[model samples]
Target chain A: MRAGTLAPGKRIRPLLLVLAARDMGCNLEQRAVLDLACAVEMVHAASLILDDMPSMDNAQMRRGRPTVHREFGEDVAILAAIALLSRAFEVIAIAPGLAALQKSEAIAELSSAVGLQGLVQGQFQDLHEGAQNRSPDAIALTNELKTSVLFRATLQMAAIAADASPLMRQKLSYFAQELGQAFQLLDDLIDGCKHTGKDVHQDKGKSTLVQMLGVEGAERRLRDHLRSADAHLADACHRGVATRHYMHALFNQQLAMFS
Target chain B: MRAGTLAPGKRIRPLLLVLAARDMGCNLEQRAVLDLACAVEMVHAASLILDDMPSMDNAQMRRGRPTVHREFGEDVAILAAIALLSRAFEVIAIAPGLAALQKSEAIAELSSAVGLQGLVQGQFQDLHEGAQNRSPDAIALTNELKTSVLFRATLQMAAIAADASPLMRQKLSYFAQELGQAFQLLDDLIDGCKHTGKDVHQDKGKSTLVQMLGVEGAERRLRDHLRSADAHLADACHRGVATRHYMHALFNQQLAMFS
Candidate 1:
């Protein structure tokens, strides 16, 4: 996939995760934390690769450059995507100092986010018959599968690594859900604006938030999701001064984007 | 991919691991064993998907059926392959009553095997500029990267799940190495024969065994590799009656094919 396409998106999820890990006392210098960061980024990268493939979005350009399929050919693009995903797992698995079992759980979590219950299924839902014209609920469903799960998994893995309590993890999961929705909404807007000549509003035919609620309603729901995301950061805020700072900065950045 | 193409290709590695697990006293039920078997098969399926992509072998047929890319478009094929891989992880990750972490570890192992150090790197080597008409050792380097690591990881996961001793796990790894070589050799023979008129000996040119030794020498090497596979299994053999029976049958079946 074109690095340029990925470059267009703010790497908000990974940055938050790295910050969260730091707040939870994970050593940035540790290979595991570093590996985790790379793993999350690879997931982000893989998503773009798939998104740009001829079937999914049929996108010609991304990040102001030709998509992977366009540049490398479909065969190389697909293998390259697979290669990135596999390497993400390898990097984490081979990291030093983490117990073998911890490494395993991390791998499992990542896989779950990408697999049937997650990205693939989400993509399938969009691709399935009658899905092209999405209802609001259907669009929400796609957003959850295609985007939110990875955001959720990212925090879950970092929190698990930091040995956070179950409650903390739950809070983080909620935050991820909201954050993911916000990100998806942003994607819809960008796709709508930039892909005017293409099938930008094809989601209107599928089960998408845009189809169900109209453009204005979808934007409103996005705000609500962002609010929840900010609210869920309360626990993190209470935990430590550094964490509060991170939460504030993250929220501020998101707020600016929405504005 | 056609379901028929994925029909039980000996399932040697997974069966060996489950048997090893039993021998090590893990005592999993038939259902659990079956699940692991499926997981292993999924890995095999995923490998086929990658192998058939335009960049790699660009093989149109697999196991006498159309490849995934042929059946579905390249994009769907890629997603389906990923779906299979993710499902395999799900099977292992959520195997009933197993520790979550253990499941995670198995997933990590499989992913690593498929990723950079394993299949991906192997594919990379095959696709590299230096790959064409390389020396035997260079070809071996690609084969080991592409095929052998996965072979080793399969046994290792089985051993880990079975709680086998570290020493025994080492033995299984050795067995897997030889088995992998034998398996690849068989692949070479099949491809060399079947694809002779289709294109250049595409996969064969990617082999070290063939380049260094020539086709006849490579044939001898394959036979030697199988012999070594038998020998390694023999070294690991012990009191497990079922395992012994299965291993004997497996070796005979594969050995017969080559003969």
Candidate 2:
């Protein structure tokens, strides 16, 4: 019952994708990149479904409700995650506006990020090291998996839809990746200090930045990343309107969260 | 680790890909398809790795060796699997002699198969009804995940590579999907009756054809699938020299396995 119990997430990634496309001058409708955006969000949701399973995090609650596994059992949770991921691709593949080649490109980008190197790798790293003693590097690694790579991919996919210039595309990627790390750092900070609904001090054995460098150091790392992310956004400003507004809004929110 | 373990699998899928290319007069070196072929095999391997995890089959052994998780622990096993998967895409994306768009197509095809609709979906179906009583439909659903979709993807990908006629491609896909199902049926027959290194009857509560139909009925289904796979291959015979040999060889092996 993930469809029912789980409050829907922010849906920010897809919005960024569509907004980026608009910046590039492409007209995105429900049948176009909007469909793809949903697909990407589905992937994100699937990751969370799997992540919160008994075998993984064993998390009891998520988004203020029982996780997919808790609501439907582990098997159904796994199946639901798989269903969402597959449907994500199918929806995008069949979307009206994407040409065969473009469809191919979109699938590749999305899959690569979600696939072994991106999300799965990140998960493995997190679990492997999370079980061990704390270290700054360990926390950095987790951010990459749980956060950065996907952010980079989200922007890249958006750029593909818009056919952004290579230089502009690279710049956007830098922005997204850094921002993602910053976001994850904030998440960890929250998770570590406060119990929320799940386990507290659960990351004790893990190589968290906080455990390694103390709270002060982890905060510094996140702040530095925020500056870097903002710089990339400023660079994207040279591109045009849609890109500028999207970057500005996202960064401002993140910056405000930290402040 | 996989490099040392990477012996020639049946090489059935790769050969099909090459033969399909030949049908379109797309002759390339063994080296050209080597990376792609390896990538394909890696995908297969990654699925196997995930399938045997403690969370899934909980098998202690596979292919006569301690499974990846058993040897390296679950965390590392997962990472190794992810590494194989990501490297597969990297291989396809960077394979020599292909244009950027073509490389992108290869990566996309592989990704689609391994992502939601392909292997992951199959895994979901396998786990969805965990610890529950088996039914005929549940068995069929398991087969859909554990076998058919990837086989369909393999042949479809071959056609894409060679730019095969739509009619020819359709026939080829039919051959591969049916053959794959038959192979899985044979696998169940072998596992249910003789295999000892597995959880065997404990399919985490999901049903198999052998479980639902009994050994005799499952055998009949296997035979039927084999017959269809053979007929499809025969229809695809006029395509090319390589295509004919590849199809014939695959059909013969399937027959030989049961005989």
Candidate 3:
């Protein structure tokens, strides 16, 4: 679990969560937000471990090192993944200074993101549908399931922690959805690039938006998503400059590789 | 997830939870108790799926059918296990009539039972140490981790639901530990027996109490545990006749296989 979670990587999901919480005007102590952020990252780490298993993506490298299943045996890898997942919930359940109701809501949000309707469904679809001639809508839905669901959960959790109004939560949800789609598109665009420091050509045979739209068209859609995400952020939170700056910097860094 | 969870089985963990809750004078509506019981069963089902994976026990059969990974692909099976696990917490988090604090406590208990201090550590030790020469104490500790920890959590959750006194909770914990040990020992004794369903001889060549102490000695030890469990239960709850009867019937049925 330590090997998988403590590895070097950009914690983009946690950053998104923290920024969203701040943008939502969360007044909780730093520890509470950090705990929730860590929980989100742990969930991400657990998903990545499973994705790299021999039975899944079967990648050899992750974050520039051997995958968890490669470094440890498969049994250990599976157990570690579960341990991390369990720990993620445990952290939330015991997070100091948060109301029990808030914690329960957060757990509900995060668990759904990891369960049948979220990562599990997405991964299953990707494995079963990726190589098939999937329709554009089907591919986009899978992308949303794979990526946007967790992002939605992250922002929702932040909203819950912040006790934000339902309207604000709705706007943030839209923002997360657009941002998640853009992030995945960026990932698809850079699938085989070197500086990414992980497996290359992972989508080589997969039926992704990038496959159907071609590079230039895909980049156009990516920009559209970014624009929509920015609009939603602007409507949801006036003081979201940090979030806007971080997102643009991150996306530009990835897109610059194409240039 | 359905294939793994809805399969026919005794559902002993859930039964134990319900009975323990009743024994503790839990006054919640039956729905809340049932939901919690289902959550416990889901966790057990998820564990079985992973335990029967090719990398673990590699068993081909479970609950009189092909193991989950055999019936579903490994990827699906893995996802199903995770989904079940996530759903377990989700169920607890949303259980009606449970106070937010109680629900949080239950989630914490269950998650820890599944994490490093419980199933993960136990399985790791078993995989690494079961084949090696291990002391009786070492084997006992492993049994506590693998089996008793979840039982402990179940009873503790019941106590929480009932809002039972701390002293009563401690007694129930003792009862659960003893019962869990006896249950594992009985399972070890029944290895290679056909009427038990599932794959037999799962402990073959492994260093177990059954191997070290032989059949009669192990059976005697099992009896000792049952007796201790009974004593603890009697001390903890005066209105526990139903729990006592169910436990006796279950254990006697398993022990009768020897006759």
Would you estimate the TM-scores of all the predictions?
Answer: 0.83, 0.80, 0.98
Off by over 4 Å in 2: A1-6, A24-26, A86-94, A99-108, A115-117, A130-138, A192-200, A212-221, A239-259, B1-9, B23-25, B28-36, B77-145, B192-224, B239-259
Clashing residue pairs in candidate 2, if any? A86-B116, A86-B117, A134-A207, A135-A207, B122-B145
Better of 2 and 3 by lDDT: 3
Lowest lDDT sum, 10 consecutive residues, model 3 chain A, at A23-32
| After superposition, candidate 1 runs with Cα above 4 Å error | A1-9, A22-31, A94-104, A129-131, A193-215, A235-237, A240-259, B1-8, B22-36, B96-108, B128-131, B192-216, B240-259
- Model 2, residue A35: C-alpha shift (Å): 3.5
Pairwise lDDT winner, candidates 1 and 2: 1
- Model 1 chain A, poorest ten-residue lDDT window? A194-203
**Candidate 3 chain B least-lDDT 10 residues:** B23-32
Place model 1 in a CAPRI quality band: acceptable
> lDDT by residue for model 2 over A69-152, one digit each (tens)?
777766466546655665665665666766655665666677678766688877877776677764566567667867777777
lDDT of 3 by residue, B1-259 (tens): 8878888888888887788788777654667788888898999899999999989899989988899899888998899999999999999898887899998999999999999999989999998899999999999999999999999998888788878889998998999899989988998899847866589999987999999999999999999999999999889888667778889999998899984
lDDT, candidate 2, at A227: 80
For all candidates in order, the CA lDDT equals: 0.69, 0.67, 0.90
Q: Global CA lDDT of candidate 2, please?
A: 0.67
The total of clashing pairs for model 2 equals 5
What tier of docking accuracy does candidate 3 attain? Answer: high
| Candidate maximizing DockQ | 3
